[model samples]
Target chain A: MTEGSSVPQRCWQIDSSRKGAEIIRITDADGKSLIRVKPGVSAVIISSASFLEVILEEGARLELLRPFLLDQTLEREVSLSVHQAKDSSLTAFMVTKGSISFKDNVSVVLAGEGAEVSLNGLHDLSNACEAHSLTLIDHVAPSTKSDQLYKSVVRDRGHSFFHGKIMVRREAQLTNAYQLNKNLILSPEGRVDTKPQLEIFADDVKCSHGAAIGQLDDDQLFYFQTRGIGREEAARMLVKGFVKDVLLKINDPLLRAEAGGML
Target chain B: MLNIKDLYASVEGNQILKGLNLSVKAGQVHAIMGPNGSGKSTLSKVITGHPQYVADSGLVDFEINGQMVNILGMEPDQRAREGIFLAFQYPVELPGVPTSEFLRASYNSVCRHHGLEQMDPIDFDGFIREKMKVLEMDDKYIDRAVNVDFSGGEKKRNEILQMAVLNPRLAVLDETDSGLDVDSMKIVAHGVNLLRSKRNAMIVITHYQRLLNYIKPDIVHVLYQGRIIKTGGPELALKVEDQGYDWLIKS
Candidate 1:
């Protein structure tokens, strides 16, 4: 159960020595959650909410899996903020499916030295739904690192948006950050919009960002046809292939299987 | 096993093949030599029923079940199931789809078309490995993405590998020699030569007579301005190699 004012709030304090995953459901009209991973501890959090605050103390590690597969029509805006201290690491995975109109905005701050963060996300949208995912990562300390990859498969009239910005401060020398967004539009009616921005004030940093969006390659399809695979089956294999690499990043075998089964 | 008559085809508003005609019986090897933009590749695409290459007025009849049936209306995959293949000049690179998986699916599709049970993975792996050994391709290629990051010669060899795996009856090798080195070309030619038999026909499209030296076509045809200008024995290829296509195109 969550403590609430007008909007329900679910709060959890993952104290030191915590070593397990916790699944929390945000079922209210609009919900917020506060997750704090104490120093030197590791934990996994799976949750759904409109507003989420995640804090990782020194030497803490966190893995977050966010699954949004609700069939209900969700026309809502969600925002997530994450703060990491020295020697902390955060790896987050998100899977969004359904004909729900939802917008997600996430910002991460590597506030202390030697922090690292990685985000892998995918959105499989159908119908006339509209989805948006915006990520802003800031490396504020020296020797910090960040990586982000987001992909989308939009079918029918669904439209997907992915906007990511990576900012490395002047003091964040020796930083390494990269971002890539790939999109697959299945039908002529489907659409994808991507914007990747990198602002670096540090000279001794490795940073790169890219975005690519398109339908399946016609020549690739024809190549399959030349080998006796019909157009429909060829398209299926390619679409399946498009989303597989993201799923492969999952280290937990059971979670990987479950995510694959979702597909 | 394949017949083309009065074929007029175009792609992207350009009429590339105009009134082209050819005929090949089973066990025959036909070498098509032409310069760039002469529609040698267009003919292969037309035979394979490429969607973009429209047949304005022509007939591409393919032998299936001992009958010559018009295949222009059939889809490319249908034409393939009935035994037509094109070894593209530039093979398409498919990322994320491993070579083994794609080949297995392709092989199984052909099997299903002919009413056969699916080949088990173990058997299929062994079968394809044997073919790979002949092409001199490494074991690492199968587990990687098809044609992705492969060297130019390696990509051409991959095409031949597929040809060996699918075993198409009428294979159009479209400049299969362009990217291959001499030694690699010999290996590919050897692999291709082994696949030639009475049950299959081949159309080798090339710009150089060097490839024809190994594949050894029975007939050599000069394709200029979309149509076959001259058809001769294998000696014609040597003559064309000695003298450029200018004399033939002028005649």
Candidate 2:
């Protein structure tokens, strides 16, 4: 290693708690990187947008928390790709807070037997912020499983877009894949567009996908009001509850509680 | 604690309650029994200040802090803070609002209304578990989403549980015994009976007299075409049970 070099370090380290906690920031100089998870290791990586190619070794587990939360007005596109080996698992939580525009594309390929992956995302937008997501999961081997849920809460003039696709190959017998996308539009001006696609070539594979976009239930609002909650507070509770389950996937309790208050 | 006089209400240009008049004292139980489309449920909505149910004219007043204030002029939550509760016949299912959190919010809202200290989640956990004993309910109900996937009986018990927790001045049980089995009815009636006190009043609205067999009322009123037609003792329910509302509507 050259001390005067401008190249960033690529060393991977594990923490003493056996659960790796890291913050990987994406900068202009480091526009791309390759991540190889060691076998039988578990780690949690918190990162922002960059070109990330992750390969999970056999029996390895990884939790990725990618949050595109910005204070300044900006627009950007992010791409993430992952490949899984035998008996490996990965869960990713991608959150997009209000912004000018955030275009996120995520792809995963389960190439070995008994591999599993669960991916969840939440996008809360207001003040004309725009969010777009395209996710694809491919089951390439037998006995692979994938589950995904993505949700968005839009208010004011904000708009959200989601397109999710899953593919099961002919050799991927006994494969299971499920995908769901739900969006809540809180105002008349707010809008949501969602689409789910599933392609299966294996007869023994189980695959399902669904998408729903709507507003909060009026009956629920009245129920809360009858219990002495004001209309504004009731709406807040409903909005928070709409995204609570998706946020609960964050493995960190403190961060989960903090996220509950935000979009 | 409640006074209703010549109250006329409508929904979507359809008049449901036409000049309905009834008076509830602070320490009395009133049972309003009537046939379908007789404004029994509309009257309940009028008191709770439901937005769709418009009160075209007349007065619905409750004694709030020793002043006879017309509650129809207040917001729904304001009326609720003034000690009015309605146990919904079909409790709305809240998918992500935990029962414990909902109960605490309700209890603390009432406390904040009356200038009392609000209990945090930890203390509220113990406070609510103690109240759950009155309904003979399993403690797991506190962990679930409110009324989501709960059976009819469980939902009723949960309503009664809320009533027990809030301890409101006026409680209107609208057809609470419609879908309950005998055993479940007894449990619900037991919970409701336990909450009965002189400081608070109850208005039990039911189609059948079976619920009255457990939580007996002091006065029974037969509502027909949005007005109380007959007011009698407990035997009034028995007579309605035996003869139905045909003779009452005629006379």
Candidate 3:
């Protein structure tokens, strides 16, 4: 067993040589670890994902990378049950480029006070391909906070699906949580389904969720064209701006640049 | 500098501009006065090559260096490249597009077409700042969305701002002075007059003659029954303002 309160593990990117990859590890209290997986790679987490019943040495970080169309998939199941830990953060980037699908299920128990979780997911799907993303975040402890924001843009006949759920238990008081999903449909046939749901049982909690799915604004497109930009180029720029908010939040620069190129 | 001869157009099979003709020379401002349904808006859309308005037959030409080139076949963007600018009556509200970016693109397109060097970001920002001063617009408008959530007066000022940046050879102001207060009208006219060079021309389209009070036109054409039936000097505008377009129904 690895026993250390302030030890740093070198960041690791999943070895893509294998057809599939799996990782199962537990992070002890006051421990820090970094993991990055590249394209054509798969990652699964079976242990506690963040600071919960297990104390996450302050500033524990996790990075997941999913490159463009790779005939590969990403499946993650993480649970955080921190009771009294303070200042523990989890940052993950699940980038789906080209034709890729990702399924993420995350649950956080905030028996502890002053714990925070931030999840940012971005899917860059273009051409006549499809990309799917599903994320679930749960709040079971009081005085805990969580935020989830996912954005996607579909060009051509590209299709994308996003389903985000936020639940606040009766004991989770002073819980500040928000979930937002926004998608832009570029073509007439391009499709996207976004459902953002919130289940609140605590009487003194602040939680809100919103979902918006629409095509490019016609007036904006005409405004650009009248200024000398053709229809195709204007459409491309609008789509790029839609996905930028998600890409900018990713902690990894190389992954952000690669995601921008895929679009 | 501009001429439209025997123009016929319609929207969704409903004829609007039926055999219309007009001409404007350099160093002159011409006001087109007409009723609401008398095809005034249709003429503006047809001249700018709006896709919705189908032109069955007509010829629009812009004289460059004493050479008349037909522009009916050109698209709206193409017409803009050939020095034709239309200040829309109801400016479109583009929510996501930044005002500065749109202006720079338009300014650079025209300059590139005329074989002029493209203005860098610093120069472009300065150019717009100076022009906004003429319209009394604030500096914050530079980053706002194009006409998005702007008041009536602000939208009109934005149109003039675009006109000042583009500096086209022939400017077609379609009801630029409508829906503006007396103060905003004066500011819009001041901007228009400032851009009135000897080598450029203007065609101001409006229902009332109030706009003519600010930017006095050299000629005024009374459009009735989809055609220009009467032509006179600036006094013609006052006559219609007092008498109204009801007289055209009889003539």
Candidate 4:
């Protein structure tokens, strides 16, 4: 279904009931989208797909919260793109969990001067699942800023890949961009491949990226155990703390609580 | 009360505690002094059930609620919940878990083991604040990550603070004064002294006699080659401090 060109004041939610291959275009200058995937729907047979596009005109503001619950084996894909105009701002929070094979592609372009973008994502994978998330952020105009943080927890034989690319064009001077990807592997068989790429053609721009993948620290675990916390409880505490900073990026209290419960 | 007889322990195929024996009674502080590689640290680990250590033979017994409990087969956490606390020589740093949350969880876990009610967050904060005051610690430490980016002295003080919070029946401090400065050492000693009571016991393991000056021990034992070679009063630590362990090892 297509949302008209008028600005939207109310939140919009898209679910599996919409069926295969849906596109949502947000052309309004100050429109917002709160897209949440409904729970307990099996995506294996549905093969659902969604595409989201947001365009922010001059001096416009937009916020998006997309939390997906993938409790069963499912194959699904989501594509998101955003274009910001001069003095425009966009903030987005996305969380995905429990997909057998899932793919997400997100692209944001700061095409106008004084534009800003902040994107944060959290993915929780378990039980031989394969998930991939790719994000591309482009700073095309001067005085544009963008920040991205993505964290994932992999358990059992699950595998996850995060590829983030931030490009600062030659004309995008005074551009401030930052990107980080951190993963926690809970089991020996779990695997995570994270690549944080930065392409900066402007000499005066500030850009940085970091990626890390590791298991729980033995010493830290022992510290908790020594405090009379059971092994299971200590592991749970560590995992919760590992993803807490990223999860707090979600401003909605209900959504934050839901995401925390999933972890 | 704690008792160990002919304790033989090893780690990674290396026997660290060979035929070691010791006993500690409630309301008493026992100081174990020895040279490096003399199983001083290993004895503490064996008592606390460190995962890396393997107990080949012998038994570790603790009197809990007037009953002798064999702690040899217990898990590390089980041993802890049974009122056994080990203040590590180097406390591990947890970068994201706040100190207050960790301490409260630990306290509540032990409380739950004894069929007691858990303290609410507000009450726990107050309890921890009072405990920190005993160590002369700042209130800022409660909000920071557990031992993360802490100075050497602060880490030692934090260990004492944890011991105070847990209030274990048997506390084994492993070289707690190793990295502490003079002022920090006194604060730590003061905290330990305040925790002393007739219902609890402490085993202070150290390499020097300097720490003995502050927290005076009732008995001092010289550990050598995985065994206690000499047992004496507080004067034994001073003897080791004056002449070092060379003469003891040669004997």
Best by DockQ: 2
What is the interface root-mean-square deviation of candidate 4? 1.0
Give the local distance difference test score of model 4.
0.83
Higher-TM-score candidate of 1 and 3: 1
Let me know the TM-score candidate 2 reaches against the reference structure.
0.93
Q: Which window of ten consecutive residues has the lowest lDDT sum in model 2 chain B?
A: B73-82
Model 4: which docking level applies? Answer: medium
Error of 3 at A45 (Å): 19
- Tens-digit lDDT track of model 1 for B1-251: 89899999999989999999899989999999989999999999999988899999989999999999999999899989988989989999888888999999999999999998888889999999999999999999999999999999999999999999889899999999997889999999999999999999999999999999899999999999999999999999999999989999777
> Across residues A1-263, which tens digit of lDDT does each residue of candidate 4 receive?
13574443444443457542333433332234423333322111111225566666676655465566676555767767777788877777767788477788989889999989888888888888888899999999999999898888899998989999999999999999999989999999999998888899999988888999989987677778778998888888888788888877755565567567766
DockQ of each: 0.71, 0.73, 0.35, 0.68
Question: How should the candidates be ordered by lDDT, best one leading?
Answer: 1, 2, 4, 3
Fraction of the reference Cα-Cα interface contacts (below 8 Å) that each candidate reproduces = 0.75, 0.64, 0.29, 0.61
lDDT of 2 by residue, A1-263 (tens): 11463442343433344545443343332365556778877776666636666778888888777777745666778877888999999988888787577788999999999999999999988888888899999899999999999999898999999999999999999999999999999899998988888889999988888999888787787788788888888887777788888887778664565455457
Candidate 3 colliding pairs? A29-A55, A30-A57, A31-A57, A52-A81, A52-A82, A53-A81, A53-A82, A83-A112
Write the residue-wise lDDT of candidate 2 on B81-101 in tens digits: 888999998888988888999
In model 4, the runs with Cα more than 4 Å from the true position are: A1-49, A250-258
- lDDT (tens digit, per residue) of candidate 1 on A1-263: 12353432666788854546543343333567778888988876666666887889999988777777748855767777899999999988778888878788889999989999998888999999899999999999999999898989999999998989999999999999989999999999998888888899989999988888989888889999999999999988898889889988776665666566666
Q: For candidate 2, what is the DockQ-based docking class?
A: medium
